[model samples]
Target: MQVSNRIAIAWPLATTAMHERVDALRQGGEDVIDLSIAISHFPAPLPVRQAVAAALREPRLPYTAVGGAPELRAALAAKLRGENGIAATPAHVIATNGAKQAVYEALYVMTDPGERVIVLRPHWPAYAATARLLGLETVLVDQPDVIDAAFLATLPAARVLVVNNPHNPTGKVLTAGELAAVRDWLRATGTACLVDESYEKLVFDAVHLSLAACPDWEALGIVTVFSASQSHAMMGWRAGFAVAPQAWVSAMSTLQGPITAAVPALTQVAAAAAFGIGAVSELLADYRVRRDMVVALFAPVAWAAVAAPAAGPYLWCDIRALTFDTQGFAELLLQRYRVALMPGEALGCPGFIRIGFIADDEATLRRGVGAIITLGDSMARAAGGHACSA
Candidate 1:
């Protein structure tokens, strides 16, 4: 048997691979603390649960249009209008299994093979992975602290640009001004934009502004994707949708027909309920406390520097002072201390690590952080360096 060239060239997403390793260790009776990716400890919002329950009581769940049930898409369009400021109609909405699928399909329909796609570094692995799967040339640039006209001018021309608001790992939310810069850049470059706002509702300090919120959004050719996974703690539900120009939605729907017809009927129900319910205040409070605790714990550690992120569940730690080989450090930490984390190399950055502080309880979270500090201190001492303050 022979595998296709595309399959042979690609590797499993590093974040998922680490999570599977943790799952395997636990299954083998080895205790492991997983911080590779954020998985909320909370359950799906009650409204979402009730909506699915209501759907279950129906006589028979029939398939809807490939895009979504007309009503569901209408509701999602209203969400885009009221919540996101995007002027959308049912014709512009397409329900997807999750944000990942929406991203894959958007890139597929928007760009051809060998076309350039610009992705900011320290991004979600799926952005680069999906581009590779479709055989697009990915041009990676370092994510600037602030996105402005000057920074935008430095990027190479590309067919599409992928933007993650309230970004992964670091949780840096793009401000309204930053979003304006992006919109202006997109207009000037005539480059299509794919904005992933999956973490919009996870915000803590700053507000999330959608790049497609402007009046010229359709003219700009922007596709904004949303997911229930992070916002409503509905990871396993795999409910998400994309808001695009009507033609783009039709193209994505055509591609989706042969792949996965429509999102499961129940998932569309959950999504309608999930996005309607605003921020999960209780869950946000819990995550805020955890985020602060992790930042405070790392404050005294000389070898690591972590800031309180504006949004999202992961903490990005800079460990370049200790070593640049974060991959090796992460591997040895998992082997020696039984703690799992994402090495920055996987996210297009080195000498850093991303810790997800949302999954485990406080005690377990503390223990995991302690183990990491202990290992780093040991490594520093062995290298004849000063001990970590922690």
Candidate 2:
């Protein structure tokens, strides 16, 4: 049997593929330290676990509405209004398996196959991959240090713009001014917006602001997606939801029904519990320490430049001085040093790599960093020796 032409050209997401490779090696008894993706060392918050426990005690779990149980939707609406400053109601909300589903459905409902979608460079892989799968043209622009009106003016008009707050890998949180500029640009261009706030609760120094928090969100056609995977350390739970106009939510729900009906009942329960708990201070504190430690470790190394991010669990390291073929560097590091990390090529920027410092214990994290430095130093030395001999 032959695969469909659409999927035949596509490969597994680089981030997930690398993590799976590490898993395979570990299962074979190899000691591989994985920093391929952000998988928190901490477990889900106490309340979420407790909520799932209580739900399990019920006699039976029945199917609810396609979007979510009424109660769950209502609770999520409250979360949007209170925490995110987005005025939402149950009709404006739809529960999803995770943020990825929300993103796919939003793009599907918001644009036609031939329409264009604007994505910033060094984006989460799914944004481009999903757009491609939908047969939509993806316009990738280099993300600027600041997103002001002048910068937004340079972008071409498109059907949709994807925004990631407390962004992945880089952890650049959009400032209020930047968000206002984007909102104005959307209003001016008549382009819809999809904002992913999966890392909202992981902010270290900067504040995470929702793009759709303004009064004109509904008119602007902005859909905001949230996930408990990173915020609550509920990666396996796959609990997430989206806030959109009622009609868009209805359309997304119609689409979600056939693909994967309402999110699991227990997940809805866990989501409600997780979102209601607000910021997880303890988790934030731990991640901050780890982030600083990794940044400090890379400071003395001349070949790598790693900075402390204001938010999120990953550290972005630039090693262009050593080599631009980060894909090969990552592969060799995994094979020879038994450590795994995400190459910047996967995130649309070569000569860089993303290191997730939130997964293993302190010792393991230190060891992984040491291995990376050792490999990079060796490569630098070999290059120097070759140059002198020539």
Candidate 3:
């Protein structure tokens, strides 16, 4: 039996990998702590839950329009205007299964087969997998700081550039100036930039600067992807959409129509309510609290420094001082210490690992950090030396 190449492509589901590795370790009766998945174990705010419960009562069980319910899109329009200062309307947005699907649809709709796309490395691995599905050649750019001229200069032939702010693995938030520089390059070269703001609302420090905020960026050929998963903890609800020029909206619409007609109408209603939370700042406060706990634990670990994730709920750590490559080291931790984390290599950061602060329980967070530190100490001891010199 033969399957299409697109379906045959290898996709690294990070959370699944963590679960499998941790499962094997536990089956062997080894106690393990999982710090891999970027999902919040905390409950979706009560108001949001109540909203979803109320939505279930509506006659939204049937399919809605391809772009999504008009009301939800309108609410998102208000959000874009209020939060990011970008003007949008429901007509220009097409809701999909989730941000991942919106991103996949962006790639599918924006490029034809064999077209060139640029994914800045230390990026979500799924970005690469999604490009490969469409048979697109992806040129990767690796950087440790804000996107620069050299980075933008590398993708000379790219038709689209996928950028994730408060980046998945790295948790680096580009300022307006940094994004502007890239936008200038895109305008000069006529390259399309698909900015993924999946974790936009999970910010811990500063407000997320939307690439779509600057008027020039929107005109320089840009598309934006957002999901309710992180912000509203609506992962299971599959609430995501794309905001783009009305002219190109048809491409996404045509692509998403046959796949996911729209994000659930009920999800739309629930999300609308969630997005209006006046107390939503608590989410950021909680993420920061957990992030700080992890940072404090790793501070004395030696040979490692937290990247100080300004916006997202994680710390993109530089750990090359301990491991040759993160994957092997991470696997060792899973097998030996039973602690699972996402190896940085998957994000194109070989010497690093991405630690997500999804657990809201302070005691659980501290315990998880302790397990991680113990694992690191063991790994260091096995190396015949300390990772951090005292």
Candidate 4:
């Protein structure tokens, strides 16, 4: 017997390798600064902590309803309705281990083996990888400098579209007009969308748009998935929920029952608490400051080009001037400077890198950015002289 062909598919390796290298360096007491994964350094809200502790002492630690505890689901539904302008009820929500699970489940329910799913570029690798895992082909559309009829024409044939708003890697928050265009396309094409709003509360520019909030979303088939992990700094808690039409939610609930049974009783309680008070404005302010700091720090890196992100906590840097592809650049940067940032190849784009600003404190950010800038200089000199490798 051999491993399943499905399991054998090649996933992104550069980012994972960088992570492992960072871990090894940390274990060896090296002063490595990690900017790869989008982990938050901010503290979780006080109420959430208290709730988790209280949940531990509750009498019944048994499995909960597959969707979630009714109170938690209802709380999330209320949050969605009020904040996202989506008309949702408890019956339309399905809680999962995290948005990661919710997204996978939605794709599983919607996709067939050889059908195509559309994904936007400079995206989270999981969106494409998961589609491939289910044997669904991924049709990638690079974020156009301008959306046009020609570009929009490329979308309709795909069975499902995966959208990450306040988009990952690039941190681009979609405008109202852009969201409207996508909504119109989906409605016209009869395509379904899996909307990942993981960073909804972290928007620093333009408002976040929820396709689920579109007036005719149920008619267009939208599945909006969200996580408490990013907003509340509850990464380890793995609490998330999805809002969709009642029938789709019901199917997800049933499909989810046997997978993990249900999200833990304790996690659900804590997440419910998190949703009750909401993402802290103080944390959002801090992240925005760091985002600005990172952009400012990279301003002098002559060999790198980056745009200030409009939302989320990343600076997407284009390093094509460095004379190496992203995989090589990431490996070399980690080895030479002890700086760990994600290669854009992991997100389906080469010659770019995503630097997450939220994980590092101000001092760490300064040092890491300085290292990258210095490395850029070295790379520039090498480009004019000789080939370089790490």
Candidate 5:
């Protein structure tokens, strides 16, 4: 049997090694503190869990409408309009297994094989990998200071561009002005965009501007994706939705009908409940406290400098001063320190690492970060004070 060339060349999902090591340590009876993945440590809001339980008892748990459960779509549309300033109706919504699928389906509908897909680095690896799997070419560009003429000149004739705000790994929320510039660039280049706003409520000191909220967003060809995974601590539920132009959404629905059939019936009901319960503010409060805890813990560490993440649940540490190479540092920390972190090499930056702060209790976070501090000191000493930055 032969595998496709796409499968042969694609890089494995970067977190796979982290998960495997964590499991190995647990099996060996070693205490492991994981900060690699961004899953919330908190439980699902009581109301949403109760809703899912109740929904399970109902007998109507069959395949739903291909786009989504109608009520959930309506609820999502209302939330997008009321909170995120994205003017959407149920007619323009398509629910998916998760925000990842929402993004993939949007790409599937809006782009074609052999078309160029532009992604800014450092980025979630899935963005580029998914494009490759779909027979699309990925053009990776260093995230620039501005979408100016020079930056525009470097882009290929791209079909879809991926943007993640309250961005992963770095956690910097894209400001309104930045979004405006992106909108202008998209229009000028005749490109469509898939903006992942999964961390919509997770912004800390900055505001999250949705591309779909841009004036004349439809004309600019933007698709905005939101997920209950982060907002409601429903990662296992795999419930999310996307808002795009009606025609594009219809096309996605048609594709989804044959692909996934529908997102789980009961999960959709729970998602609708999640939107109505209004518990996100409380969850955000917890994450905010945790974020602050991380800042205080790492503030005085000389081997590495920590920037308070402007949004999301991560702390992006510039570890170049500790070690010029991050993957080596991350592996050493995992094996010797029993702490897991995301190396920036996984996200296309080589001198940093991302720590997800919301996935562990304060005591565990303190301990994990303490280990990282120790490892940094050791690595810095090993490097003999020779280090560099990105």
Candidate 6:
């Protein structure tokens, strides 16, 4: 059997690879402390669960339109306009099965083959995969906590400029001034700015401003993709939407029809309710406590350090001081210490490792950090290393 070249070019995701390693370690009687995946440690909000329950109790099990129920889109549109100051109507919003699917649809609708799109790194891995799958070329750029204006000017005019704020894995957020600059810069070059605010609700210590709010932004192609999956802790609910110009929304609606129909009616209803509640904030506070606790364990040691994430639930740490690459340290720690973390290379940052700050109990998280430090010290000492130099 023959598979396509796109599938062949894809790098198997690091998170899934770690899961297989974890299973092997577990069968060997090792106790594992997991920090690999990004699943929220909290349950869905009460209203959302109730909505799903209500829908499940119904007899229809019927299909919704490809763009989802009008009620959910209206609720989302109202929230976008009233709160975020983004000019979106129900006509410009579509609820797909999940945020990931929404992203894929937008990319497909907006892209022509071989078009160049700028994807800022250390990013979620899927962004690159999606580009490759569509035969679209991705120009990988690095904005280490937002680059200087001079450096950004060097890029060629692009078809689209992609960014993930309140970022995944690294959990960094771009400031308002920076966002405005990107909007202006991209618009001037005729590049559509696709600002992914999937982690928008995860912003803990900063304000998140959208490119859509920039002057004449809609006319210049500013698109924002979002989901209740992250905001409402509703991953399984698979409820997501994209906000853009009416034309783009119409394209997305058509593309999503057979690809991934509208999200379940109950999920969309619950997502509408999610917009009115603070379940996301309350849950973030809990995760923040875990983040602080985990960082505290590494704080005492000078050899290892965690750059406190501005948002979401991850700790992206530089571990190259102990080894040549992050995977060396991650693998040794996993084999001996039984703690799993995402290597930064997977997120496009070499020599760093990422730990999900809220994946485990506070006690377990603390212990895992300690194990990493201890194991790292030994490895660095034995290898005549860099990271564990105390």
Q: Could you say which candidate leads in TM-score?
A: 1
What's model 1's overall lDDT? Answer: 0.93
Candidate 6 global CA lDDT score: 0.77
The parts of candidate 1 lying over 4 Å away from their true place are: none
Provide TM-scores for the models.
0.99, 0.98, 0.91, 0.94, 0.93, 0.92
Worst 10 residues of 4 by lDDT: 381-390
Candidate 6 minimal-lDDT segment of 10 residues: 381-390
Number of colliding residue pairs in each model: 0, 0, 2, 0, 0, 3
Each prediction's Cα RMSD? 0.9, 2.5, 2.5, 2.8, 2.8, 2.3
Task: Give the runs in model 5 whose Cα sits over 4 Å from its true position.
Answer: 145-156, 386-390
- The reply for model 6, stretches above 4 Å from the true place, is 20-30, 385-390
Residue 73 error, candidate 5, Å: 1.1
User: What tens-digit string does per-residue lDDT give for candidate 5 at 156-197?
Assistant: 778888888878767777777777777777888889999988
Better of 3 and 4 by lDDT: 4
Model 6 lDDT per residue over 1-390, tens place: 988887877766677688678878889888898887666767888887877788789888677777878777888888888767898889988887776787788888888989988888787777887888888989988866565467678777789888787788777778777776776687567888777887778777777766687547678887888877766777677777888888898999888776767777777777777776743667888877787777767775556668678787678787666554787778777778788988887878887788886655677877788888888777666777544322
Residue pairs clashing, model 1: none
Indicate the TM-score of model 4.
Answer: 0.94
What residue pairs are clashing in model 6? 321-386, 321-387, 322-387
Q: What is the alpha-carbon RMSD of candidate 2 to the true structure?
A: 2.5
Best by lDDT: 1
* Candidate 1 residue-wise lDDT, 217-294, digit = tens: 999999999998988899899999999998899999999999999999999999889989878999999999999999
The local lDDT score (0 to 100) that residue 331 gets in candidate 2 is: 93
Q: Write model 3 residue lDDT over 241-311, tens digit each, in one string.
A: 78887766777888777766676677777667766663367777777777776777788788677856777
Ranking by TM-score: 1, 2, 4, 5, 6, 3
Q: Kindly indicate the candidate among 1 and 2 with the higher lDDT.
A: 1
Better of 3 and 4 by TM-score: 4
